[model samples]
Target: MQIQDLPYPDPGVPDAHSGPRFLWWLGRNQLGGQLKSLAWGLLHFTSVTGLPFCVGFAIQAVVDRSGARLALSGGLLALCGMLIALGDTFLHRAAVTNWITAAARVQQLLARKTAQLGSALTRRVAAGEIVAVSTGDVEKIGWFVEAVSRFTAAALSVVFVCVALVVYQPALGIVVAVGVPILALAVLPLLPRATRRADFQREKAGRATELASDTVAGLRVLRGIGGEELFLDRYRAASQEVRHAAVRSARMWALISGIQVLLPGLLLITVVWYGVGLARDDRITIGELVTVYSAVMLLSYPLRHFEEIAMAYSFSRPSAKRAARVLSLERATDTAGSLDASVPSGDMHDPATGLLVPAGRLTAVVCGDPDAAGRLAERLGGHAAEEASSDTSVRLGGVPLDELPLDSARTAVLVQDKDPVLLSGTLRELLDVPGSGDITPEEALAAAQCGDVLEALIQGSLDAADPMDARITERGRSLSGGQRQRLALARSLITDPEVLVLDEPTSAVDSHTEARIADGIRSLREGRTTVVFTSSPLLLDLADRVVLVHEGEVAAVGAHRELVHGEPRYRAVVTRETDEEAAASLGEVLDGGVVEGGLRDGVRDGGAAKHDPPKKDSHQSHGSKHGKPTLSDVLNELEEIEETA
Candidate 1:
């Protein structure tokens, strides 16, 4: 059956009630296997119980007549023992199979849910929590499932043995039967405490997993900032919390275990005491007394499952809740009717920023904050908005983005991040994304400036015809930072999305390589609407138009050179250099002397302008006559100039 077709109850708010429902749901799904296991467990337990009865009969026969009859009874007892041994081995095998299969089915359900939720999975649950649920939680749930049949067999054995005793000796039989249930149910009071502690421990463990995953993901950045020690300390603290939680959980379990052992022992003593009294009174046979004791002893085994099932349920219920939370994440809306998978052909517009990205044009978005750029990119790509801003609207060809089907929207707009994931595979396989064969690998590689990557791939024995056959290590860990970024860019380019949104695509590469890639991308994506969010001068210079964003609003829109010369704030923000020439020009204007440098030099001289023409050695020698000015000095001068103008 298809994964989608698998039956799963909407595990509503996992709590005490949900645990039973989950088990019922699992049983319903695997009814055949469960029934088989139950039958085998009953058969095996019955055979084991029969051995004690056979021994009692043999002893009684020997007492009554020490001839052929006693020998016949002894042989019968030996045969029963062998049968009991054989049944037990098969029963154990069947029960274990049931446990493994049940756990596997639950794991499949979780895996399917993860696939359905996709990227939305992380928004609702931690990565570590998912890991814990799939691994540890599934096993615990299986333990409870397997225990069900074992417990059933144990309860039946107790009843069967009690009936035999009653027929043989009523007074002793009643005590054993009545006291077995009391011993089994003795742990009920401790269950609530155990469950609570287990829940707490699982929660803390999930947090520790999340912290570790986050730390590992950002290890490079942490080391770069010399904050690895700080993060490590935080992880240690979280680990300690998890340890304490585990100890708390263990304490409750230990108490329950003590009761499980102590209560059963007490019940056994009570049974023996009553049986011995009947024997001394000459009311019951010695063989009958031994039979009664063996039955009680056998009943203890199943009684343990009762306590264990309670503990397993307590632990698994919270894990199921976590898994359910992840499964509940809503997928992005698919607006294009399922049949309309056609590529979109039009300009992209964001009314929130009053920005128009014209079709067949290269657009550069220069936001003062990197986060703002990233958010905008996410919105344009049809991903969920990171913030709650009703005023913001992204549209394609005048169609509201939200109205478009998710698949179509995604196909039309692609957002390539600075660090895109590279699945383990040969470099050729990595480049071959969806719609790969439509465009030649050579074209995509050239567009992404991947000539060197291609050489490395060939050197590593990657064949063009069987690119997917190449093995990529986990997350492409074998690749350098820049190679990984370029490979991701290449994958996106291969898709040939109608509107491509790139965030700092060239941020990791050197200037020379960045410049080459910038030119190649402009040429390769000539007729597509491409919005590149970057502070790199080479990429900025290649854009047809640059939109400057400040204070969460569009401050200006113009060609890169025009924006550099006309907008002092844009230059300061992008280049991160002081506009000293602009300040000096302001002083000259105030002194009524012609500024020696032109407007380009005035604004570009001291500041780094992303689109400013390359500076010659001679230009560097030129200095402002006024004292060295900072970007703030330029801003102040611009304010004065604006007032005078």
Candidate 2:
């Protein structure tokens, strides 16, 4: 049958049934082409069978002194040879077309299923397994499907040849017919073992691919922590395991190959032995004996197909099962009712922590643990945790988050993550998310405090004209960390959802930039329900109110200043600049103490009453005299500490 006529297997069927059922389904769908190809192949096999008969006829004609019959038989044999060659060529062409089209259809189905699952696909299946299915599995499935037509044609040709032999010489024909089936069926028992080994080899290969992908993605982190050697050693071990599996698979195939060759050779020998006896007994003429022998020799070619089909199936079955598994992944769903036509209009609530973000107001979430804040954000955005006991329930307008239609829910509540994904695109294109409407690029950039980001774009020789059109590389690798974060923020602002949820939007920028972003966000997101999940003091101060999260629950809720004084955890979490800042501050305190001691020593040694002439000081004089030392002064003290050490 033509490959175009083959139907792709239904993805909903059980994987266990996919192998056999898929083959049957393909046959049923492409029956017309298959029958045509088979008919032509049979005619070719008949023409080939006539060759030996014509040769025998010529020999007998020469023996009987009939020159005309000998010449006619010779011409008939030549015509049969040409016809056989033509049939074989056409049959091969049709079969190959069948294979390629079937593979293409299956691949198309796989692509559709992948799109149907969308972002949820990776959560269900390993990315490497998906890669293996599309690249390796599709080809194997097509190989088997295409092999089916060729194999059938070959088997039919062998049958036609054997019948022609039996008609010419009964004794020789019976032997040839029985022996050919034996040769073809002999390899069936060995196939199970070969398929098992092949499955094991494919599994190992998939695992190695997964390990390699993971290694590449985390290579930067591995090098940063000096763990590259450790991961490389692990990958090396995985590679060795893959090699061992491949060797085992090859050994099984080798055994199958040996059987294919030996069985066919033995069948040829049996046919020759029987035909020689018949010729000596004078029951068959010398010419007929030669014809029978020739037919038996031709039958050996198709017998080899039996072994090839077996090997193709052995490799393809496991590949189909792997592809089936990926196609079978179900989309994620919430237990709550369907959310079609639901437009959330009130406060957003997180039941897990008793945190409520009132509608049309700016709210800041201050978490003692950033990890907890991140988890809260994920739940709020409708990404349900696999763990059953994760009792976090987020609601919009008093309706449970799980009840919302996935698309509508996502559109309504946009979660701009701390490390938001910056897909490869122009800056303007990145700002326009999936459902962004008429929001202007300039407004979005301004609201994000992206003036400096635009300046950088201008400085860089990007191919696009406008700063908005400047290309941002994959994952924003081309941009600095802060620039990427700001661009992500701009994208989020453009969406302008009913409830915009941002997790640490200003964490990467400088304090001045952070303040601007904080002010800009509040001004732009005027009437929407906005939840900023951050402990940044600048962002927190801009909020109408701050909710303090501790141990995955809301511990305190009030204004940012109120929480800072009342909640020590909130204060420690936000006010702690960094390790470098702490070290600098400690050095400054020590240096100040040394200076005070030096002044005290001078007073004691000079016998002064530790008094200085009071320089005409007003109310502002004392405050100015004892102003807090700047971070630069602290850094200088730290330099002294380092020098002394």
The lDDT of each candidate is 0.71, 0.71
TM-scores of the candidates in the order shown? 0.80, 0.75
Question: Which one is best on TM-score?
Answer: 1
Flag clash pairs in model 2.
1-33, 1-34, 3-98
Ten-residue segment with the worst summed lDDT in candidate 2? 603-612
Tens-place lDDT per residue, model 1, 104-181, is 777777776675444546656777677777887788777777767777776777677778777766787788768777
Backbone clash count, each prediction separately: 9, 3
Instruction: Show the colliding residue pairs in model 1.
Output: 334-405, 334-406, 335-404, 335-405, 335-406, 336-405, 424-472, 425-472, 426-470
Model 1: runs farther than 4 Å from truth? 1-27, 65-124, 156-169, 332-345, 386-393, 397-406, 457-472, 578-645
Which candidate comes out best when scored by lDDT? 2
